[model samples]
Target: MVSEPSDAAVPGATVARLPYYLRALRDLAAQGVTTTSSSELAERSGVSSAQLRKDLSYLGSFGTRGVGYDVESLASYITVALGLETEHRLAIVGIGNLGHALANYSGYEARGFQVAALLDASPEVVGTRVAGHVVEHVDDLAAVISRDDVSMVVLATPAHVAQDVADRVVGAGVREILNFAPLALQVPDDVVVRSVDVGGELQILAFHAAARAAAL
Candidate 1:
């Protein structure tokens, strides 16, 4: 059984690693594994055993010294800690290629998030249907967000319009945003924005590959 989440402040780095640990735990559960050690989980999560243990420590004590951590219990605990205990409705803005693909993704619901609305600035695209959601006009962003009770937003618009869309999203009272646009967004201190620059990530990968090739 999952215990109540601790009120202690978890560091940002630890918070980031929590999802990885949760994923690893779930994989174990899927394989019919009921228990795991810090070392084993860390290897699966691509982190060190000591680091995994320290990160989980912020969530309060878990696991047994000899038998290791209960897979189901630890997964449940991490789920609560990561705020996945409740579903979060999302509004995906910009029905461009990337936005459309994101709206069609099947994984969100399993992870406790629902893509409740899809928005786009283009009139041609606005009334179209994608992923079972009829795209709404961007001008109706606030209304759609309010109507759907969306708690999070995914900004898939181009760089130039990302900030404008982000501002409107925040104005509508959503606190969490996932930005796939290429630029950094300026949001209020209370608002959290996670940017995914796919091109930038590819560039980083290319740099690593080049470095390896040079060394060889």
Candidate 2:
């Protein structure tokens, strides 16, 4: 019974937290739970009940007054909102240790990302087989992308050269990019880039530990 927004403007924080809610709802469904109260879902998603209610309001009112939300229906709605309805063809560029590990991960398949190709600049590594797909050379990127119809790419190249590789991918018509290199990338407004800053996360964890020690 959630109302659809005419413009569908979902806040960034709400969008990011949606996956947590979806995971919690799926867990509830697995346990034979059909309905859940807002407080229960909020606790599972690590958010306040009021915050969860506000976040869900963006997608219309799908909750009941006393019985709460339908687990299956809520999970389905979040899945659709997060665009997990279709499989996205993807490529992993750089083929370094991190890239190699990511290429072998089976989790991406479950999340709707299909790793169609793996690319690298090293001739010694190129043509090597990893995770059932042949590692193609970066020079052959356009051809590989064309052959596989890759819609997104993960950049695992060195931080210094990640932007150059990004430029190449953008030139080849890749609009969605996930960057694992420890640097920011510049791309045209038409293209979207999401970066994983591992160092920053570690620093935040260190800061929290320092704060705790200082309080002690």
Candidate 3:
């Protein structure tokens, strides 16, 4: 299980690059590349050689001086560091357009996340088959959470309902949440909330364009 951020904190930049390193390592491994130099790994991950070495140094010196790093060993270390070794239970809430797409998306399972259930507030949409499983009513969120031992909730609800749904998700003892709603959600200090606003990103780009026009 990916426990809360430990008292021993990792640098944010280092943490961010770990996933990229893991991805590169996995690709290399699949290609029958057993061992890789820091330079090669850096090229694969879009990081400079020195920066890659520095980031890996945070996980202790795993690379051999003369032979470079063992691909399998490095992959194992990064996997454990990112808490990808264990299967994480996840649930999708809202089951609207984005939510429905997420429920059907096959990529989450590849990254050690298992979609435990699909939930929506509408009775008309509920009980409809999504990816493979039918959507369940949001009234059953707690029941599903308990039955499935979901530790993470993906909030795909509308902005208006996002916060309330977050409160309920946190109350259900979920520790981590991925919010796709446009608005920010306020949660307890211990609860981790990550937001991904597609609309917000577009709006920011629009502002940049307007600013460029003004500069002209």
Candidate 4:
């Protein structure tokens, strides 16, 4: 990660959504729009205006009274606040279909996260290169992680393997994990895990929808 500016520790939730705000601002700028009101930004981000304003406030003084904010300026502020102005090294494990997609994907790079290495347990997939990083055997995770000095790890392994991979990653000195598997992991309190389980989220939405329908 970039030299974290003293002002970079936005709330966890705010840090999570600053990229969305930055992207929306860029889209507006691309459309030839120069400025926007908080309400407009709120619409773009699917957040309430108050929340949007508060999040922006955490970054810095971004808006002007009555005039709102300049799209490009706001985008720049959000990017800097999220520590995306500099590059971060990331390690990817589980070279299956999902892992391959992440390795090939350019979104993380655009946000200043560089995929420094890829690892998998299967011998067949080892020695392969995806997104310019040669795939190494999972057994090499510790050496690769330490060698690359990566702080973030992406776990795209199967659910059963997620915790194991995460454990190794923690032991190897990784501080943050982005897990795509559908299982909870055991990690030190200092290590942060962000789980992205599509099925679980879908099920939660279904439950809420059913409750809303019943209320209606």
Candidate 5:
């Protein structure tokens, strides 16, 4: 594998690929597999062996050269690299239908993110329990973030309210946001926002379907 000088920051592509490595490592461990060769894991992760080695080098060494990698050790190292060594606390805003599903999702905890608070604007659903936390009014977002020490916020509100919610959370000291609402958000350069564009993904699928039919 090619080695570059010590990186001050992980490259964007490598950061994007870290989850695949982490998932492969964890899945292997669950199967009671202790040691794995690079090629073996590459097959499991769909990342080439060379790329896997390079990606893992970001964390130091894969493991002992002759014996291959120890599954549990590698997973732990990747977890630390991904900043999940210590769990990060987060809150989900807009507890409507989409928000309710996200709040109740167990996968977040499995990946080391704990949902600390839930917020919404509707008086009808406020104080209702979904995913173990009583839904608080959206007006209380700032107080909830402070009380829970929330570092991340997930936006699940309607398209119309997404930008406002994002502004409120950022002003309340949340720098990282995962926006599930189907709308573009305007935030300061210092703040980071990741958007989940479901419609765009569906459009791509539609394009592929049209191409297949045309070929036929």
Candidate 6:
């Protein structure tokens, strides 16, 4: 595995595409494919070969002239580049439907994330178990976060409570967040927040589908 240079600065767009390349490399490895050309890797990742090459260039050269890249090596390099080399513990607040699903997701471990704690404001949910974790009261969020060594938080609460929960999480010293709430959150400049708006995504897909039908 190639060590990413500490001083090398990768762009946000390139950082986003790193996961796709890693997934494609893992898929190739699972198929007993030991090596892959940029074209083949790009095809698997749904990006053009040229685009893939450009993105990979930010991580420094690795592929051979005629031989191509070793799948495992490339995957490992991307893993380190994306900061997935170590496991990140996550605390999912709000034991509602969305929160429960996120806690139960098996894919997190494969991507170097572990659901370390679950919290909810509701008294009924506080003592209940979801995904093998006893839901703690949000009142003790700071303690739970520190105790579990939670490095990231997933906010799946309602729009009204999401910001309040986010504030609490940030106050607890967690810098990374994945927000599934519909509304935008106001976080400090140092904190990184990635929002997943399911409704907005579907609306975009619907617009594309309608445009395709209209052209036909």
Compared with the true structure, model 5 gives a TM-score of: 0.92
TM-score of each: 0.95, 0.93, 0.88, 0.87, 0.92, 0.95
User: Candidate 4's error at 79, in angstroms?
Assistant: 1.2
lDDT over C-alpha atoms for residue 40 of model 4? 96
Local accuracy of candidate 1 as per-residue lDDT tens digits, 46-106: 9999999888888888878888999999998889888999999999998999987899899
Question: Taking the tens digit of each residue's C-alpha lDDT, what string does model 4 give over 1-216?
Answer: 112234656688888878789888988988999999999999998899999978876766667788888888777777777777888899999999999999999788667888999999988899977888889998989999999988799999998888888989999988899999989888889989999998989999999999999999
Off by over 4 Å in 6: 1-8
TM-score of 2: 0.93
Q: Cα deviation of 208 in candidate 5 (Å)?
A: 1.5
Weakest ten-residue segment in model 1 by summed lDDT: 1-10
Cand. 6 Cα-lDDT: 0.91
Per lDDT, the best of the predicted structures is 1
Give RMSD (Å) of candidate 4 vs. truth.
3.7
lDDT of 6 at 44: 93
For candidate 4, the 10 contiguous residues with the lowest summed lDDT are 1-10
Candidate 3, poorest ten consecutive residues by summed lDDT: 1-10
For model 4, what is the error of residue 139's alpha carbon versus the real structure, in angstroms, after optimal superposition?
A: 1.0
Candidate with the larger lDDT of 1 and 2: 1
Candidate 5 displacement at residue 206 in angstroms: 1.2
| Whole-model lDDT, model 3 | 0.87
lDDT of 3 by residue, 90-109 (tens): 89998888988888788886
Candidate 2: give its CA RMSD in angstroms. 1.5
When superposed on Cα atoms, how far off is each prediction in RMSD? 1.5, 1.5, 3.8, 3.7, 2.4, 1.6
